[model samples]
Target: MKPEDFQFMSTMLKQRSGLVLNEDKAYLLESRLMPVSRAHNIKGVEELIAEIRKTNNEALIVEVTEAMTTNESFFFRDIKPFDMFKDHVLPHVLEKCAAKKSLRIWCAAASNGQEPYSLAMILKEEAAKLAGWKIEIIGTDISRQVLKKAEQGLYSQFEVQRGLPITLLVKYFDKQDDQWQIKPEIRSMVQYKYYNLLDSLTALGHFDVVFCRNVLIYFDQPTKGKVLEEISKLMPDYGMLFLGGAETVLGVSDKFAPVAGQRGVYALTGK
Candidate 1:
């Protein structure tokens, strides 16, 4: 691939999805976009770049962005966060919202629905406490493809094996041929939507809890701060944010601070 092509792609990706691709990932562009090119009957990455430049095709642009963004997910990934949600966040949010009798949770960059669904299962297990309350789990992702999979609520056997326990899997999922599908009740608890984290989040309204795990590491410092700041605005004083185990808000933004004794969990500053 030409240097110009690499630069164009990297810049476009950063602008469109906040994904920073350095020269070391030039090979990744070739490997990932080659299939997209072939599927569209384009010749190669060079030609793909030329076509995108010439036409500015919105569909093609979306395809390219979706191809580049990672959609890796599994149920209850990195267990500790969910443990915190159950043991800490949920009880606090429940008490805080007790008078309102409603709760809203957002799973940003929610790929294939696992994270939100995991929360749904947890909520289901606590049905007695939430008997008369309204609950909403909103799962959003930039990739429409993954959102479709999430809406379908289907998972392969291998997918179910990862990070999912036997008892919960048996209780919540029904075997459909070889793949397991989450029961409709649990599936109905979450709603999926197409969203880009870089875009304004006002229309989505407020959320009491957000899970934006493993997404900020791909962005540069400024983008990270911008996203964190925007997310902070969407939460109340007591709201909680869950990030990837490797990600943090220390240098990125002052809108949030690490929750005391909780790794990968953050609370709004001054709360």
Candidate 2:
């Protein structure tokens, strides 16, 4: 891609999804957008950009943004967070909301359904503890394609194998054709939606725990702070934000503070 073309694409991605793409990442645009070009019968990224530039088509622009955005995920992509939830977080939430006997969790970037389903398994195991309680797990992603797959709750051999233990896999999944399908009970626990973090989250209401992990690293500092601010609004004072182990809220926003002794968890410090 040319310098001007790269700049246009970068600007478009930032405006549309808050993803920062530098000149060095031109290759990323070329590689990810090639599939979009082929799908639209455009010759390549250059031709696709030229056509979108000429027409200013909204649908085409969205398609390009979705294509460029990374959708990589796996079952319990990081192990420690889930462990923390089961060991520490859940007890605190239970104590805090003992009267209502309800809990809500939002998996902000629940690509293809693994993270939410993993939560579902834990919830199932603790069903006795949460008897007659209302548990709502909402999984949101910007990609409609991934939302569909998440709702289906089917996974390839490789996908299920990643981070999934053999015992739980046998208990929760059954062989269907070539892929493994999560049982309907687990599938029904999660609600998947096509949600962009850049958009309003008020429609989803409040959450006790918001797992917005491994996602903000793609944004620049300003965008990172903006996204964190948006997430903080949907959480309670006790609500916890889970960023990637490498990510932090130190200089980003005053809405959260690192939970003492917890590596990746941040406690809400602002409304």
Candidate 3:
């Protein structure tokens, strides 16, 4: 890719999905977008970039963005965050929202649905306590392609193997030939939607707990702070935010502070 073309692609990705592509990652453009180029019969990535430059092709642009966006996810990607959610976060949120008997969770950059589905499985385990509660789990991602896969609730054998316990695997998933599909009960517990972190999140409404794990590392500092600030607006003082183990709110925003003993859990600042 030419310097100007790389700059154009990187700028478009940054604007569209808050993804910061540096010069070192220039090679990634060809590796990831080549399939998109072939799918559209555009010959190669350089041609694809040229075509995008010359036309206002929304579909092509969307395909390119989705191609570059990482959709790497697996069941319970990390054990620690899910453990925090089950042991500490859920209990607090349940207690705080007990009067209304309602709880809402948002999984930003939800990828292929494993994160939200993992939360659903945990909630299912505590069904007796939440028997009459109105539970809502909204899983949102920038790529509609992955969102579609998530809504289908199907996963390959390799996908189910990652970070998923055998006991819970047998309990929640039904094997359909080689692929495992989450049972309807668990599948119905979560909803998937296409959302960009760069866009306004107000329409998503309030969430008692949010799992925005493994996402912000791709963003620059300003974008990270802006996204965190916006997320803070959707939660109450008692609401919690779960970021990736590598991500933190410390220098990025004043809206949240780390939970006393938790590594990846954070509570609203003034709380």
Candidate 4:
């Protein structure tokens, strides 16, 4: 890809999804967008760029942006965060909201449904403890294509093995041909939607716990701040926020602070 093409896509990505692609990542753009080129029947990235330049259709621009951002992810791709969710966050929320028997969890950048499905499995395992509780686990991403796959809850053997424990796999998934399909009950626990972080929060409602992990590392500072601010608005005063291992609320927003004894967990400091 040409340097100008990289810059153009980077600008478009930042504008469309708040993801900042640096110059060194020109190779990544080539790797990800090559499929977009082929899908659109273009010969190469250069041709794709020329075609993008020819269009004013907002839908066309959205397709280019979505094509660039469809990252590969699986159930509990990083184990520690889910561990934290089950051990620390779930326990806390369960105790605090016992009276209501209702809980809302959101996986903001859930790619391929793995994260939310993992949570569903955890809840299933603790069925006795959460008896009669109303659980709503919502998974949202910028890519409609990925969300559709997520909603399907089918995973290849290789895809299921990534960070998935063999015991839970056997208990929660059923074999369909060569692939594993998440059980209908577990699949129904999560609601999937196409959501761009660049957009407003009014339509997303609010959550008791929000998992916006691993996404901020790709954004510029201003975009990160804006996204975090929007996230803060969608959480309760005492809600929890989970970030990637490398991310934090420090210097990003004053709305949250790291939870004691927990690595990536943040307690709402909006108090």
Candidate 5:
């Protein structure tokens, strides 16, 4: 790809999704977008770039963004965070919200919904204790294509095998030919929407827990701060924040404090 085209797409992506693309990332773009080029019947990256410049059609923009957005995820991708949630956070929240008998959990940047569905499976196994609680699991992502797949709650065979235990799979999903479909009960437990982290969180409402993991590493510092601030706005004083193992809240925002047991889990605190 030409330097100018690379620069243009990088700028466009950063402005739209808060994801930063450096000059060294040209190869990354080429490898990821090569399939998109082939799918569009374009011979090379140059032709794809030309097509992008020729049109700003909504469909084309979505196609390109879908091609660009990272969708790498797996059920219970990291065991420790969920362990912390069940061991520390849930216990605290269940005790505090016992009178209300309700809980709200949000998985932001919920690419294809593995994180939320994993949580649903966990809750299903521990149903006895949560019998009376009103559970709301909301999953949101900036990519429309991903959000649609999340709502369907179907995973390809390869997807099911990755990071998912056989017991949980047998318990929560039904086989449908080549795909594994999350059962209706688990599917109905979560709601999904298209949400850009750059947008306001005023309509999202406060949540007891928010999983904004792994998404921020792609963003620049300013964008990271903006996302963290927006997240803090919709989180209660005691709400929890779960980030990627490689990510952190320290020096980025003061709205949260790291929880003791979990390395990446953070709890809302006075900022």
Candidate 6:
């Protein structure tokens, strides 16, 4: 609530998660983190800030960071990337990796598991095409809360309806009272992990395609460029990167260049 409190939280988020919270976003402290305060038995934002300052509690700090960073994601979000994956990207990557009989994909900023699960459905549909190939999909997020939801593979009707066609819904998900759970076959195709883009990605192994969508928009330019480079490094020369429709790597970094005909797709410049 106080200017000093706002500045403290804004700096803390930027340092911990690369989140850029402008002064105008001070209201988000109350809107997003009040529940965190309530959970810790703090009275209000002012009291919460006071407690954080007084105690310097690491767990409490983590809780506040995770609470503030919880973002919303729906299945097949924005639609076009998944369509592109099904129509063009898969066919190309399949041909390119056919000799190896394997392909690896990473979905960064993969909230609540929808994006990777959507890809899993596509893989399920293309089982015949990938008959002997080994497929691996890893979904990563900063929030452990959403990762748990993702691991459970459950979704409400509203979530399933958004950008997810009725056919795929009926085919890949089964009704569970009021919610739908992804079939085991599809759910088994993906793995979820706690990862921060700021952390070293060496342990995850190289990926043939990386979907770091809609995430960079929250970072300042320096952080954005840093994350883009980190992602590009994990990609092999022939690997592809899919960013959000509104995001671009043109001025941010030279690790990648826009693909010839794809809107949000980029390929290593090999520079």
Candidate 1: the clashing residue pairs are none
* Pairs that clash in candidate 5: none
Residue 224's lDDT within candidate 4 is: 81
Each candidate's lDDT (Cα)?
0.94, 0.90, 0.92, 0.86, 0.87, 0.89
**Candidate 6, residue 160: CA error in Å?**
1.3
Model 5: per-residue lDDT, tens digit, 23-57?
88778778877888898788877778778888866
Model 4 accuracy (lDDT, Cα): 0.86
User: Candidate 5: which stretches are off by over 4 Å?
Assistant: none
TM-score for candidate 6, please give it.
Answer: 0.97
Per-residue lDDT of candidate 4, residues 136-248 (tens digit): 99999998878888999999999999989999898899999999999998999999988888889769887989988889988877778888888888887768999988898
- Report model 4's TM-score to 2 decimal places: 0.95
lDDT of 3: 0.92
Candidates in order: C-alpha RMSD to true structure: 1.1, 1.1, 1.1, 1.4, 1.4, 1.0
Instruction: Summarize candidate 6's per-residue lDDT along 1-271 as a digit string, tens digits.
Output: 7889888889989988988899887888889888887887888888988888899998888888888885788888888888899998899888889899899999998899999999999898889998989999999998888899999999998999888899999898999999999999889999999999889888888999999998998899998888888888888788999999889997999999998888899999987
Off by over 4 Å in 3: none
Q: Give per-residue CA lDDT, model 2, range 99-194, as digits (tens).
A: 898999999999889999999999998898999799999999988888899999999999999999999899999999999999999999999988
Which scores better on TM-score, 3 or 5? Answer: 3
Write down the TM-score of every candidate. 0.97, 0.97, 0.98, 0.95, 0.95, 0.97
lDDT of 6 at 220: 91
TM-score of 3: 0.98
